[model samples]
Target: MDKFFKLKENNTNMRTEIIAGITTFLTMAYIIAVNPDILSIAGMPKGALVTATCLTAGLTTIFMGLYANLPFGLASGMGLNAFFTFGVVIGLGVSWQTALTAVFIEGIIFIILSLTNVREAVVNTIPLNLKYAVTVGIGLFISFIGFVNSGVVIKNESTMVSMGNFTSPTVIIAAFGLFTMVVFYKRNIKGALLWGIAVSTIAAWIYAIIDPQGAAYYKIFLPEGVFKYESISSIAFKLDFSIFNDPSKIWTLVVVVFTFLFVDFFDTVGTLVGVASKANMIDKEGKVPGAGKALLVDAIGTTVGALLGVSTVTTYVESSAGVAEGGRTGLTSLVTGGLFLLAMFFAPLFVAIPGSATAPALIMVGFFMMENITKIDFSDFSEGIPAFLTIILMPLTYSIGDGLTIGVLSYVIIGLLVGVYDKGKKKVSNVMICLAFIFIIKLIVSGIG
Candidate 1:
C-alpha cells in the first residue's frame, strides 16, 4: 500500500491516509440522501437515484485514485442537481429523460476535450490570479451552501435573507457543532471536523429520544430498520433521447446543453484547483500534475451518472477535509471511494446523519479555502478587480458559472486596458477574449430561452 500510494514520498502514513479518507467521507456522505431527495423532485425514482448516487461516487472516485492518483472525491454535485430538477425539468418544461440525455452528452464532450488536451489548454489560459480567485470564490459558495442547509440563514421577506431562529433545535445543534469544530481546529486536532459531525449527530439523537416531539423538530433520528435493499433498475439506462424529435425546441436544447457544459466545466476546474492548492499539488506556474487524468475520471463519472439516473458527478469540495487531515496521496481517495461503496449497503445509517452535522465540516472547509485570498495581489487593479468580483459574486449570485463568467470577462477587458496604457505590455490572448464573448452570448441566449 505504501509503495502504491507513495506514502512516505507524500510525507504521510497508511494510518493518516485511512483516517483522512474516512473524514472526507463523513463530511460528504450527506449526498447519499440529499441527491435522491433533490432529484426525486424531478420525477425520478428515489430508491434508484440513491443507488446511482452511491455507485457513481464510488466507481469514479476509485478511478480517480488509481488512475490520477489524487485525493479528491467524486459525487453528484449539489447545485447542478438543483439545476437539473428546477431549471431544466420545471423551468424549461423539459422531461427528466431529456435532461439526463443532456448530461450524458455533456460528459461525452468533456471526454473529447480531455483526451484532446483542450481542457488543459483552457486551464492554462486562465491567469494564475484568476485561478486563485476561483478557489476563494468556490470557498465562499460552499460556505453559503452550509449556512442554507443548516437553516442558520433563511429567506426573509424584508431583507432577502436573515438569521434564522437560534432557538430552533437544528440551528442550535449546528451552532454547537461549529463551536466544537472550531475548538478542535484551533488545537490542531486530526479529524476534528469528523468529530464535530459525530458530536452533532449524537446530540440530535439524544434530543429525539428525550423530547416527545423531537422527531418532528429534527431531521435526524434513529432508523427503525437499517437494511433496505434498493435496485437501480427503475432509472437505469433510462435516458430519453427523443427530445430531439422536436426541432422547434432545438435552441432550448442548445441552451440547456451549454448551461450544463459550462457549469460542469468550471465547477470541476474550480474544485480541483482548490483542493490541489490546499494539498500543495500545484507547482509555481499553476500546473496541476496528472490533471488530465483527474478530469477524465470526472468526465466518466458524469457520463455514467446520467446513464444510471443522477445529476452531474464532479469532484467535491469536501475533499478538502481529507487534505486537511494530511492526506496527500491517492490512498485517501481510495479509502473514500471504498466508504462510498459501503454506504450503498448501509444507506439508512448514512441518511440518519442530518444537515446540521455536515454543515460544520463544510463551513470549516470553506475557511481553509479562504487561505488562498492571501495569495492574491490586491494592489494590481487588473488582477484584484476581477478577483474581487469572482470572490463575492459566487455567494451573491448563487452560481459559480456566473461568478467565473464575470471574472474572466473582467480579466480580459482589464488586461486590454492595461496593455493600451503601458504600451510595452503584451495583449491578452485572442482565444480567451473570444471565449469571454461566447460566454456573453450564452448568457443572452439563456435570458431569451
Candidate 2:
C-alpha cells in the first residue's frame, strides 16, 4: 500500500489516511439522503436514486483513487442536482431523462477537454494569488454550510440570515461538537474531527431517547434498520435522446447543455484548486500534479453518474476535511470510496448521521483552509481586489463557480485598466482574457434567456 500510494513520501500513514477517509465520508454522507430527496422532486424514484447515488459515488471515488491518485471524493454535486431538478426539468420544462442526457453530453465534452489538455491549461493559467483566494473562499463557503446545517444560522425575511434559537437541540449538539473539536484539536489529538462527529452523534441519540417527539421534529434520530438496500434498475440507463429529434426543443437542449457544461467545468476546477491548495498538492509553478488524470476521472464520474441516473459528479470540496486530518495520498480516497460502497447496504445508518453531527468537522476544516488567505498579496489592487472578491463572494453568493466567474472577470478587467493606465505595470494572460469573454457571454445569455 505504501509503495502504491507513497504514504511515507507524502508524510501520511495508513491510520491517518483511514481516519481522514472516514472523516470525509462523515462530512459528505448527507448527500445519501439529500440528493435523492432533491431529485425525487423531478418525479424520479427516491429509493432508486438512493441506490444510484451510492453506486455512482462509490465507483467514481474509487476510480479517482486508483487512476488520478488524488484523495478527493467524487459525488453527485449538490447545486448541479438542484439545477437538474428545478432549473432544467421544472423551470425549462425539460424531461428528467433529457436533462440527464444534457449532463451526459457535458461529461463527454469535459472528457474531450481533459484529454486535449484544455482543462489542465486552464488550471495552470490561474494566478497563484487567485488560487489562494479560491481556497479561502471555499473555506468560508464550507463554514457557512456547516453553520446552516447545524441550525446555528437560520433564514430570515428582514435580515436574510439570523441566529437560530440557542435552545434548539440541534444547535446545542453542534455547539458541543464544535467545542469538542476545538479542545481535541488544541491538544493535537489525532482524528479530532472524527471524535467531534462521534460525540455529536451520541449526544443527538441521547437527546432522541429522552425526547423522541422533539428529536423527530429536528430530524435527529437513530437508524430504523441495520441493513437496507435499494435497487437502481428503475432509474439507471434512462437517458432520453429524443431531444435531438425535436427541432423545436433543440435550442433549449443547447442552453441546458451549455449551463451544465459551464457550471460543472468551473465548479470542478475551483474545487480542485481550493482543496489542492489546502493540501499543498499544487507545485511551485501553481500547477496541480496529476491534474489531467484528476480532471479525466471527474469527467468520467459525471458520465457514469448520468448513466446511473444522477446529476453531474464532481470532486467534492468536503475532501478538505480529510486533507486537514493528514490525508495526503490516494489511500484516503480509497478508504472513502470503500465507505461509500458500504453505505449502499447501510444506507439508513449513514443517512441517520444528522447534518449537525458532521457540521463541526466542516467548520474546523474551514478554519484550516483559511490559513492560506495570508498567502495572497493584497498590496497590488490588480491582484488584491479580485482576490478579495473571490474570497468574499463564495459564501455570499453561495456558489463557488459564480465566485470564480466574477473574480476572473474582475481580474482581467482590472488588469486591462492597469495596463492601459501604466503600460507594463499589469499584464493579463491570454487565457484570462479568453475566459473573461466567455464569462461575459454566459452572463449575457443567461440574462436574455
Q: After superposition, how far is residue 32 of candidate 2 from its true place, in Å?
A: 0.3
Model 1: weakest 10-residue lDDT segment is: 215-224
Tens-digit per-residue lDDT, 297-352, candidate 1: 99899999999888899888889888978888899999999999888888998888
Q: How much does candidate 1 score in TM-score?
A: 0.94
For 1-449, candidate 2 gives per-residue lDDT tens digits of: 99999989988899999999999888889999999999999999999998899889989988988887789999999999999999999998888999999999999999999999999999889999999999999999999999998999999999999999988999899999999999998999999999999999999989988999999999998888879888988889999999889899999888888899999999999999999999999899999999899999999999999999999999999999999999888889999999999999999988989989999888898899999988999999999999999999999999999999999999999999999999867899999999999999999998997
Model 1, residue 258: distance off in Å is 1.8
Relative to the true structure, how large is the alpha-carbon lDDT of every model?
0.86, 0.93
Candidate 2 displacement at residue 322 in angstroms: 0.3
Which ranges in model 1 have alpha carbons more than 4 Å from their true place? Answer: none
Candidates in order, TM-scores: namely 0.94, 0.98
